[model samples]
Each structure stands twice: as structure tokens, then as C-alpha cells.
Target: MPRFPRLTAAATAALALGLLAAAPATSDEPLVTEARVSAHFDLAAGQTPENIALDGDGSADLTFALARQVAHVTADGATSIRATLPAVAHPATPIVTSAAVTGIARAHDGTLYVNYATGTSATGVWRLPPDGGAPEQIAALPADGLPNGLALDEARGMLYVADSVRGTVWRVPRAGGTAAVWATGAALAPLPAPPAYGFGANGIKLRRDAVWVSNTDRGTLLRIPVLQDGSAGPAETRANGLDGVDDFAFPGHGRSVLAALNSGSRVVLVRADGTVTTVLTEADGLSHPTAVAVRGRTVYVPSAALSTQRDPNLVLARLRHFISRG
Candidate 1:
């Protein structure tokens, strides 16, 4: 079966321009434009923070669970050794030893919650107190056989886990007990895997009344309107054509959803109206960033050292507020 090209007449005419124009048309949608990606913020040496966790203590903590260890440092400092996820992969690792903090959530009351969607079985979800010391297991929710992404509903105290393997979105209480099947739609379906996310869900986030799921396998973003009881509303494609969207950041008081775009050395910003723009070029030396979070105006992104990872590359970039085009 071949894809019936959805090319427009303008695109068809552009194809007449030569093979170069048609070259880009083959991909259907181009998420980034040359204008949006105008700057690059190189990675900081020591305080290279991955996975930004905004704490109520007015301090920002970064999680690095790579090479079988999950540790935390400050996004505001030049690298400070604090604590590590004690589950230990081979030695003292993040949770399941090699699995890192894919997604993290914090309550208004200042409770810290973390998710372990990869690595070994001992890995799951954990919680930290307001002051931050040791993280304890909540209960053992039923995550997709191989979980990876997560989101938190602070007001209602619900945690949503994106089980890419099972194609299911699971929910559990803040205290942690039994994982309940919250919503099962495209996420829980028998989608293909790897290279193309038939069901490869990664990053998840909650805004006002909805939850956003990132389909890295297919370069699409799903926004499922959620209710107070965890029931889902209409699910729609918020943004697409991303180059492996590992994580996203909503630079507050603005209209930008800055994302950690893998496969490329930049952070892309997608507006609410579905128009995409590139905000940074060669963002913090990002290497397929896997996790991201935002606080007020600042943005934090964590890159995965896939190949030659020397030292640890954790990046914290301040997302400049976008000026309205109108």
C-alpha cells in the first residue's frame, strides 16, 4: 500500500521548481522553519541538568539517571551533588538501575513525585517530601509492561503514566496503591514500535483541563482533555512534525510550547494555533534530549547521551518570551 500523497496544488507546482522542492515535500509536514531557530545556547559544564523538576522551595532540581544511576543537581547552580535514586541498576542507580527520570510532577503543597518507565522491574514511581531527602516508593502502580512517560494532576492528585508498550495511559493516586486504567485509546492500542511509534509514547504533561502525550515513534502530539475523575475528553493532535519530541516546555505568560527536539541540535517552539517556530539553534548542545520541564519563564531540557557521552550533559536554557506576531 502506498500513501496517497496529500500534496496541495501549490506543492505540486512547487514540485515543478525542481527535485529540491519535492525533496522536502516527501516528509509531508515540516515542524521547524528557518526563522524560528535563530539562536543556540551551549551546554553548561558542571551543572548540566537533565529533566527539570520545579520545586516549591524556590530551588530547581535536575535528574540524571544515566549509565545505571539516577542523580539530582540544581538547575540554578554549577553542579552540586545531592542524592541519587537508590534502587541501583548494577550499583547505585536511579530507580531500576539504568532507567532515568522520564517525567516528574510536583504538588502545590510541595510534594515531589518521580517516574521510572524504563530499566528493570524494581523501578516504578517514587515520592519525595517538601524538604527533599529520600524518595520512597508509593505502591507499585500497574505501568505499561514497559513504561516511559508520565504526567501529574496537582489539583486532583492524580498521576498519569504513558505505557508505550501497552499503548495504555494508567493513573494512580499520589499516595500510590493500585494502578488503574485511566484511559485507553491510541496509547493502549497495538501500535507499531521503535523507529516509528505505533505505540511509542514518551513525554506527558497536564494543562488546565487536559493531558498531552508525545508520540515519539511518529512525531505527533496528542492532547486528551481530562476531567476531575481522570476520564478523558476529546483527544486531538496539538502539534506534529517534530523530530523525535523527547520533552516539551510551556514558557509561561506566553504562547510558546518549547520542545526538546531530538535528531536536531535545537529547541522548537509550537504555538497554540498550531504554527511551529524554532526558538533556539544548537540548544545547549542537546543530544536527543529526553526530558523537559518549565517554571514561570525558564525552561529546562535533558539530553540523552546516546553515543559518545563524555562527562554528563545536562542543559538549562532560559526560554525568551515570544513576541506576539499580531
Candidate 2:
């Protein structure tokens, strides 16, 4: 059976206060009306959609976290296979028991980079050309690490990854160089569980000189500054005690983020001041929603469905009065 650890005491408190540490930007009115959005796409049974990347034309390419395939999703929810990851190349490690593609990001030139954990020791970041050519292995991560969320800092020529197992963030050069550990903190470690899920920092986003990351097990959103020397500064919590926080997107530019609650089967809008509003829930038709992507006012989510014992699928929701700063 699929397992989702219950929220710890800290997380429970945050949820009670609507997942905010400061007053909201405006009135207590909900950010987006619940009924204004609808499903934008669906996936095949057993297709575990994990992360999504928006293309130049507004289409989204999705990566299956527990599968070896990538899918191209159109604006209307149409999907097609884009690539199939090859089998594990290196010897296996006990750290990463599952071999799957966990995260994906697209470059401005239309190229795609994907992180594959064939095993802990066999994990690597592969790059695919815009023309769908053979994938090129760019950088191999540590044998004890598990790479998950991905974000690109084009100006810095760096691609950042969240190592869920190691509880650290790594910086990989876009032009192919050795990957280096960029930042880490206590907040990135998973909390105690009867059966551990091996999840910590799950989602990462870059805005200006700061990078934001979400801890799945700890239910916290943290921000780390990128210094003048391109090194990471101390990590600070922006919000805590979130519920089932998995992957998130900055829909209101840097003003707010839309997060997917994998275990709760809901999506929430979190403001700059830490105000949170439930944008969609299971009652709104989501089922174990794992990740989210934003393009303009539209938010896309992939429901893994394992928690709800249903087939995995993709759903879309639109905001009524939301404005994106991106």
C-alpha cells in the first residue's frame, strides 16, 4: 500500500494558522475562486507524473518520478512520449533503491535536462537536444545522494538540484563540469517516521539572487541567498508547518507560490507574506497531486493517485484575479 507519513507537531501548527508567518497582502478573501478552474490534462494508468517544465510555446513536458519516460503535454492536456531513459549504467547503491527520472528542466534554447536515479551510485544528469537526439550524460552525482527537484539559473550558468537523500543542494555547470554541493541545512533532513519516505528538499526555484526550496518531510519553505562569489549563504525559513508540501511553482512571480500537497491531494497558493489559501482539493477533483507548473494564470498539477488508490493523471486550474510577476 502507498504510505504518506502523518504531519509532525510543527507542521500541524502551521496548517492551523493557514501556513503563514505574517499577515497576508490583502483581505482574507480567497486568492482564486475554487470553481474557476478545471482539468487540463490526464495521464495513463500507472504513469507517475512528478515534475513539469514549461516550453517556449506554453506546452509542458513532464517527467515521471518513478518511471523511465518523459512526456510532452500540450496546453489542452494532450501528451506524447518524448524520450525513454536507458537502463542503469553504473553499479547500484543501497541509498537509492529505485531507478527513475525524478525531475526535469528546459533551457532557453529548447534543450531539456533530466535527472535519473538509476540507483544511488548510478544517478546522473542527462541532456537532450531540441531535435530529440540521443541523450548526453553531463554530470554524475554522489553515490549516496538522491537528486529530485531541478531549477536553472541561466545567467549564472548553473543548474541546481535538490538531493533528497543527502539533504543538500548541488550546483551543476550547464556547460558540463563537475557538480558541487552548493548549500545544506538541518531543515533539509527528513523527520522521523515508522517507515521513512527518504524525502526532504523536494522543490527548488530561483528568483534574482535568492533560491527557494521546500522540505517535504518537514513542511517548510526555506530561502538561501546566492552571494557575490556565487556561493550559498545561510538558509532561512520563509514558512513552516505546511501540509504534505511536495513541488511548487511561483505563479505570482516572486510574490507567491502555488504548492502541490501530495498526501493531502490539494494545491495551495502561498503569498510573499506567508499567507496560504486552498486553491484546489480532492473535493475539487484532484487525487494525490504531486507537482505543479504555472504558465500565466493557469496552474498544472500531476496527481500520482497512489494515495487515493486511483489511476495517475494531470489536472489544470485557472486563477480568476491572479497576476504573475514573471
Candidate 3:
């Protein structure tokens, strides 16, 4: 969801209030619980949950940069969407820029990594103050770009950024150092981009061990073998049901993977052995479901109509607990 933030005043910010009333933006805070998003909560109209990452202590929290909000919900759910979250614990800073938030990554300190569309000649990655500070342009993405996805290798303290246009992944050194090419998808002589369709590697997942990439245009879940020299292995296609795949995550449990088929208009799950099944149907309300993320029990999916108000952000309430069970 891209925003045309009024003027250069920067995008607006929203935070989950009430219980989060006095929560400090400091790195350490019990603001989020360890339990993934669980059942029982209501959703605000037009709030689109974008991506997921662990807070300082590993609590499942989702960043909804587009809605200019962040919501705490389950990574999987069983009942209705409302049944997933107990309540909206916190509303995040409306740190959304004019560009719709194509992707979001979380820092160990709970800071958010934001990606915006290249409107006109603008393209780059922005860092939302973990607590309360101004966002800084860390990298200026290539112009005429697709959604550049990102993942933080916590152990290595490196940020892996995927650029579909250039068909390359860059490794940004820790603590805001220069970025270098870590892995190149299209650059790989093995998995070259298709002539007709580009392999738009948009979403990235840095697990406890390796890295997983959602090849949007390729319709495959790529398992990138981590390397000591940083040269990624030839990606293995973990699943094939992805149709216009976007972003996905392991939902904290690591038994299954949830993916968004943007053009396909649905959200699907792939089990351990690459078993694919439909979880959230378009019938329930998925209009061009774009990016997705999971907390503890909740999985947030933002259905975008491409700047159309008719199809505002469609929130999939409780998700974690339910998807986990199924």
C-alpha cells in the first residue's frame, strides 16, 4: 500500500494505544508478548498488516507501514480473523512513506526496515526509528525498480536486499555500513531470469539457520544455502503452487510456510514436504492480496486494489494459531 503522504511533511504515524499507552520506544520493553498472535480481537478499517519480525525478545509483531500502523497478532489462527487477536495491543507509527510499503523487515531492537515504490524518480530503503526519531534513507534503490525485498541476518549482522529489476541481492554490512552483493539471483548463471517473465524475488526470510526467498514471478520458494564466503547455493524450489507469489514466512513454528499469490488472488500454505493447500480463499475477501506476515497466532494479509478505495486494506484477523493447527 503506497501513500501519497500529504506534502513533504512525511507520512503520518499510528501506534497501538491503550495498553501500549506508556510503552517506551526504547530497545527493551515488554510491549509484545512471546505468544504468537492468538484469537479474540477487532480490526480497524483499512489497516493493512505488511510484514513480520521478532522484537528484541522474540515477540511476534507485524509492521503495517502502509496503514501507517503496526499490529500485534497471531502467526496462525483457527477461528475467524477476529478470533486470532485478543486485542489491538499497540498501534505503530504511521511511518508509511508516499510509496506503498512493498516490504518490511525488523531489527533486533524492534526497528523496522521499510521499502517504498519508486514514484517518479524516488527509490530507496528507509529506517523507521525503533523508538521515536526521524527516518533515514539508508540506501537509494535503483530507479525503474520492482519491490526490493530485505532480510536481516542477525547472527552475521548483515542485511540482505533483493532487487528484482537488477536481479541481484546485496549484503548491507552491520551498523549501517556499505552494502555489497551477497547473492545474485539472475546474476547466477544457473537461474537466469526468464525472457518473458522476470524472477521478481520480493520477500526474504532469515530463519534461525538459513534464508528463504519468495520468488514472486518465478512461482517458487527458493531455499538459499548460506555460505561461508557469502556465495549462495543454487536455490531449490521448495514449493510450486505459488501463482504470482509475493512475501511469506514460517509463522514462528517452522513447520509450514504461508505465501501470498498476488495475481492469483489467494493466500496458500505449504507444509514441510512441500504439501500445498488453500487456507484463506478469495471468496472470504482477498482482492489482489499482496504482501503477508505472521505474529504468534495472527497472519496479516493486505489486499490491495492498486490505489482503488473500493478495495481498501483487508485484514485477516487471527491467523497464527489457526494456520498452525491446520
Best-fitting candidate, measured by TM-score?
2
Write candidate 3's Cα lDDT for 132-235 as tens digits.
56556576555555445678777887777766655566677646645576666542211343332454566777765567777655577777778777667777
Q: How many clashes in each structure?
A: 14, 2, 49
**Cα-based TM-score, every candidate:** 0.72, 0.85, 0.65
- For candidate 1, what is the total of clashing residue pairs? 14
Task: List RMSD in Å for every model shown.
Answer: 12.0, 6.9, 12.3
**What does the lDDT read for residue 297 in candidate 1?**
44
Task: Give me the candidate number with maximum lDDT.
Answer: 2
Alpha carbon deviation, residue 37, candidate 2 (Å)? 9.4
- Computed on alpha carbons, the lDDT of every model, listed in order, comes to 0.54, 0.72, 0.53
Off by over 4 Å in 2: 1-30, 33-45, 89-96, 193-196, 323-326
| Candidate 1, position 228, lDDT | 58
Model 1 worst lDDT window (10 residues): 15-24
lDDT of 2: 0.72
